[model samples]
Target chain A: MSRMILLTEGMSNPEEAKTATGLLRYRGEEVAAVFDSACIGETAQDVFGVGGAIPFVDSLDGLEADTLVMGIATAGGELPGAWRDIIADALRSGMKILNGLHTFISDDPEFASLAAEHGGELIDVRRPPAGLVVSSNEARNTPCFRVHTVGHDCGVGKMLTALELTTAVRGRGHTAEFLATGQTGIMITGSGIPIDAVVSDFVAGAAEQLVLENRDKEFLFIEGQGSLVHPLYSGVTLSLLHGCAPQAMVMGYDPTRTTIRHSAKPMPPIAEVIGLYEAMANVMAPSRVVAVAANTASLQESAARELLVSLGESLGLPATDVVRFGCEPIVDAVLEERRRVGEGAED
Target chain B: MSRMILLTEGMSNPEEAKTATGLLRYRGEEVAAVFDSACIGETAQDVFGVGGAIPFVDSLDGLEADTLVMGIATAGGELPGAWRDIIADALRSGMKILNGLHTFISDDPEFASLAAEHGGELIDVRRPPAGLVVSSNEARNTPCFRVHTVGHDCGVGKMLTALELTTAVRGRGHTAEFLATGQTGIMITGSGIPIDAVVSDFVAGAAEQLVLENRDKEFLFIEGQGSLVHPLYSGVTLSLLHGCAPQAMVMGYDPTRTTIRHSAKPMPPIAEVIGLYEAMANVMAPSRVVAVAANTASLQESAARELLVSLGESLGLPATDVVRFGCEPIVDAVLEERRRVGEGAED
Candidate 1:
């Protein structure tokens, strides 16, 4: 049997970690104890509830374990000195250790050195592929698109988006699948991981799934959470397109929460957002980039036009190549035209 | 100027949309009106604030827009009949509409038919690929691995994990990059998109980026978010592995939450949380799946071993295939061993 200590700078999201514990057990692992420097008053049992791992207040009580897994700290970086000492003490005790910090691996050097010296290894898990071979076998004749929806906790907009996208793409003479990825309520409350990473990873994962599942489809559609405000969400999508070389990629354009005032900036500028879209189009070199401002009023026509133009220019596409459809009539007209094209090609 | 109705089911997290509106304005889009159905007693001005786009109740009185973009609904399903009436009225009035309700399109066959009859197309935006891809020209002699960290909103556990993974992988004769993903906040109170999507997508995206940017790498390493009960999160990652098909995948095994509570009477046995992981491993079939579960204590050894064996069997792999390590020392050892192997191969 192995035992380990999880040292953290502050109170961790015990709920999520608790969930992870169940997963670990399902995979055949045990958690001995969790020690948090920030959570002083509460016992680990109290914090995590029954069947939860125990909590340790002090690091030096001759706690023995075959291994120790470190809890992640906040954005400011590393646990306080006391916590570091505990980690060092654990290392000296001949306990094996694993660190699960992804960003800090690249951003901090001191911690990196310490990890090396302590005979502990820090593993960053999000590195890219050795190689990717994308074939259109799965996507042939399928209407491929991505849908993004926004919502708060428990809201079903994201799910709705998945359902809708699947229906629409299927309707368009193609097969569609719902690839689910996005932030959960815990993440938004600031407990588990960063928003940017959430968006990026989801987008990429969705794309990869689409490419693998619908290899012969002519288009790729993505659906995402609407409320998050990370540039990387859209950026990562573009990067995927470049790698997989999808014939075309479509993204839902809904910016609902950007208007609010918050400590952290709400959303990126529309131009910036559009810029990312354009950048993706450029990288993927799609045949045409379509901008469907769905249900946006004529009042927003100017803004939509500007975004379309910018997107076109960034992609070095002509205005004709960047199609803008607004209102039901326009949306219908575009779809009709597409249907007609499909029909004509069949003829 | 175009007039559009922005219908929100309830309180919308107006973070990203607001910023995007400013950006839209910079890009020259006029936002006409925003209708929030949830603001029962609040005045339109109070809810919408003073801006180009005024907020109103869900009424279609003398409103006109070329397009309509539906915001996230606090309610999980289709808009109420009254709300739907307003939207239908707008559509009847010839206003173009764009909505994020991907589910509504299918949930309501009438709406789907109407879109088809009216020539409106429901578009789904597809996300780009996950992970980083570097060109062969940019390849370096050193190998690189990706690190992922998990934390609370303010915690930097992910950052640290990233840092540590990078250090260890690089030390093992490979270069390392760090990526972050996942949400960091309180447990969101609803059922919607799984939260793990955020982290999984980010990891995938980061990996895609690396691969596209540097094409010479032969493998991708992903560090996953450490959680316990939510199979959805872990499931999302497992799904992503199938989609991404990385050379190897490494994950931490800290089970505090993955267990199914057995009840005497008949509700379905709470599905094992690790079932998702097992399913994902089977589907992805990565070359290597290294799981570090060196955290359980002696008292819990039996349970831990049972869980591990079950997990291994589910994935159709041997128990020995899952690597068990103590936290610091084990991580160090793994990194060192990997590095030596890489160096040996290079030599």
Candidate 2:
């Protein structure tokens, strides 16, 4: 197995260093250390309260790793200019780079030449495959029960919820596959179409291709991208919704976020947001939000549990913070929805 | 103005030769002839019943033109391989090529080398500008009365409706600017963002940029893209819808068709479609579809007028073929909607 060092640098916050946290949480066995100058000498447990005993190193001077993973998600996925020297050093030392940013490292002349000279490989996980046609809604013809995890906004745990739900579903002895739509999710899952990196006209096609590719799976927990109300990304959100043609949906929301971050638009009531999602999905097929994955990270355990109970009662659906409480409740709701819709029924 | 020859080739039919027809209809002064071997001796009038008597030629050998325009809008914007030799010939002879396809002509190695070798320029109208960030709802601050032309399906006269409405509004002594969202519109108007060619994350940003750039115009008729019900391109539709954040919308539909052309989904009732558009728009701000621009190309004069009248009455909005009748009814309804909503009202 290749030893990996995650490069998060200035992004130590869990939300900012999502890619780093995700790999540490799910693929911990492969991660040797994290490279964050500010969090040097600290462990992942000290910084994120998880990834037990994984040490943080300031530089490659003493680290033993063959692969470097980009561990921060930038706003527009542009590579930070400050990291050039470190990345060049890594490439010069023959360490492969796994990049999830929109900026393809393989396409950069300097990086390409350095990697070619050093026998180092550059894998751009966000580079979408070519010749993707428009979606023909072929996913609808598949026999799999698709459960898409939509969100109230970007970075609200949609991917995490989907991953957890996939685990829960598979634990129940059902074959479930997690479909990744974003960079972090793609890295965790090993393969996925970077929906946001695709051309605007083929966003749905990419989502549909993911579903069709895993048609043999009994259940598909599709990781959704932006919110329906998100000012900039609603198009991606809607495209994924229609392309996946989910039989059921899990609404992911960060309760602490009252409005979409970085935009002037205020978040509508959760019930209303659910309605909007259902309405958009119904335009393609009959789909409903069967549960809610509440991100109650800001609250204490007791408060989070209490809020989940009341929220579930109000919305008349199962609600839980998959991190605090296991994904059983949400998975149970999805199973119930599948049964109600007649498991793998074609409409 | 440079003398131009439209390269429609085998796409002699008006629908297939939309770029050729659009240029001939709107910018006839620059067009010298059309290069469609299939319709060698025919004129634009014989082929499209419009554009006076611009003759079609079998080849570019004797054509006196300084520029060649790719005149077919292929599915997925791909350039037909059969047309490569002719395009190369045009480039070799030092003629500028105006391309609207998703395939950027200048990016092709051979075409790029040829254009560089010869004194010829290649303009890819669909190539999006760089550095587009997520939208922050900056367009809502613009004081212009934005009229967005939405559609029931792709190729349903959305762009033409916006162009016609702009002319009608200008004829009424109002300073109206047409915002192009597609290649044909970009070719016709000389400048506008190609919304679909952009990255999925920045579709709305591109739309927002167009509105903010043209904010000084008193009236803005923003051309729409694919339908909200269109399986392949709905994301582009929604992004354009939310990006423009129009005060009023004109519903463009082809009454002769009852379903989204290439998909299995049937078209919903026009009223419901309008409601969907309004509800999606209202998520950002108050907006409504005030009129209908019916495409009655398949129907005869009286039958088309009869359908338009009934369609308008049934939907309770001003409807016209725009091509057959004129944009007066739709423009009047838009003016009424603006008055009711309080012109240039900042909500």
Judged by lDDT, which candidate is best? 2
Q: Candidate 1: which stretches are off by over 4 Å? A: A1-4, A13-29, A48-53, A73-84, A104-119, A128-347, B1-347
List, residue by residue over B8-112, the lDDT tens digit for candidate 1.
545443322332222122222445556666664554345433244354556666665565555442211233455566556555555555543313333456665
Off by over 4 Å in 2: A116-119, A343-347, B113-119, B340-347
Model 2, B235-315: lDDT tens digits are: 889988888899889999888677777777888888888888888998777899999988888898899989988987898
Structural similarity to truth (TM-score) of each candidate = 0.27, 0.94
Chain B alone, model 2: TM-score? 0.96
lDDT of 2 by residue, A222-250 (tens): 99988888878889899999999998999
> Candidate 2 chain B: worst 10 consecutive residues by lDDT?
B338-347
In CAPRI terms, model 1 is classed as incorrect
Per-residue C-alpha lDDT of model 1 across residues A1-347, encoded as one tens digit per residue: 55555554454553234222322222123555666656666655465433344654555465656666555423212334555566566655555645443343433475455656766554332222322222222222334432233222112133333344455556656655444332221211112222233333233333454455644444334333322223123223332333233333333343343432211334454444444444323322332333333212222668756755664466443221111342332223334445545553321
Q: Fnat per model, in the order given?
A: 0.09, 0.75
Estimate the Cα RMSD of every predicted model relative to the unseen true structure.
Answer: 30.7, 2.4
- Candidate 2, residue A41: how far the Cα is off, in Å: 4.9
